[model samples]
Target: MSGHQMPATESVWDYPRPPALLRETRRITVECGGDVVADTTKALKILETSHPPVFYVPPDDVRTDLLRAAPRRSWCEWKGSAEYWDVVVGTDIRPLAAWSYPAPRPPYELLIGHVAFYAGRVDRCTVGGCTVLPQEGDFYGGWITPEVKGPFKGGGHTHGW
Candidate 1:
């Protein structure tokens, strides 16, 4: 798939291959099951080629009491193994709604204490003051904001990308 950068917008194609982990001060928030699960102005974003940025919030900023350890785990070539967390609010439970790399590979080790959520799995997620859109598939947890343009890689048939 092809994509073009627009004025005032960033093209996912312009992002790096190994992915750049950058800190952001914009307000990022996540809500689910009628409760605010996470809220933070200090966040880390993972910008990779052909995908929107994935915002990772520090564990201290999240409501840890509301998160339960999940049984699911996954491996990433760049970040190493990841552990999942389920968001629990009263009787509502979102299974494996968030993930983090407890022991990431080099360059990604900075992500140690941060957690990234799946926008589609959560009730809502916002960057700055704008709501976010989940990257086009279930596999990738990229958050699509207005300033990021995409012909993103998460959709069907993009596995070979």
Candidate 2:
């Protein structure tokens, strides 16, 4: 990645202009440390396109202190075998809430080493003091933010996730 900083004029958002397949909602609260930025249920063909329901969170939004890189790894044809992270909270830890393709495929070069989180795993998923609603099944994270409006996962025949 070129390592260009995000433009100052642009608001920090995961998908500023999501594809026709995606819909996002945004809200900010406290989760990791600085803020609990929430974007709710997004993407059409999301499972097929974006590595299976994982919510792409900007690293700044997550609590890095609690995340420890783990030896465990898994691979995908698109991105390499992902390196895993174990999230530590208090004395307890959830083995996996984060993943990254350090050396990604050419098409996904922008996302290399950029971690994606599984909202389904982490225990504290709060947005604006309210614990956000978890989506059906193990959808990665379509955070619950008012900005998100969608039939993202429920459109006619949208199943097969």
Candidate 3:
């Protein structure tokens, strides 16, 4: 919706810094290479300022067999270190398509064993039966559904925000 926030949609600016981890009951699903990689109704969503919510599905709900650890790691000031994962389905592979905070810091310890996928890296990701738009830029993993409005960070020129 560009710079304007739509009615009934949550503005990203209203989200908190350091992020808030909240339980989400909406169905979350991820598919890639013709297979459903993850599906869950019990997910945790990270709500951060200037970003759309990022959904994290418990490992038990994901097809962990299809994921291979990638030799990549990243740090989040609030969530702690993240380990990347590659999704492999037969001969098809999507590198570093998902990530998790195996040992999250305080206030984020609930993220342990939960995985979050990059919507842009998978064939499809749906929240409550609605396909989501990926947050812009390569780094952020936010999922943009109809209820979340944004002048989101991650797009070019928004890095300084």
lDDT of 2 by residue, 1-161 (tens): 78855423211233322322222233333244333332333211123322223344445545667789988778666555678887776666667666767786655555554556555566556433445444444423454433333434422355673
The alpha-carbon lDDT assigned to residue 120 of candidate 2 equals 57
Q: lDDT values of the candidates? A: 0.92, 0.48, 0.95
TM-score result, candidate 3: 0.94
Better of 1 and 2 by TM-score: 1
Q: Flag regions of model 1 displaced more than 4 Å.
A: 1-7
12-112 in candidate 3: lDDT tens per residue? Answer: 99999889999999899999999999999999999999999999999999999999999999999998899999999999999999999999999999999
List the lowest-lDDT window of 10 residues for candidate 1: 1-10
Candidate 2's displacement at residue 92, Å, is 2.3
Candidate 1 structure quality by residue, lDDT tens digits, 1-161: 55965438899999998999999999999999999999999899999999899999998999989889999999988999999999999999999899999999999888998999999999999998789999988778999998899899998879888
Model 3 clashing residue pairs (backbone): none
| Candidate number with the higher lDDT (1 or 3) | 3
RMSD of 3: 4.2
Q: Best-fitting candidate, measured by TM-score? A: 3
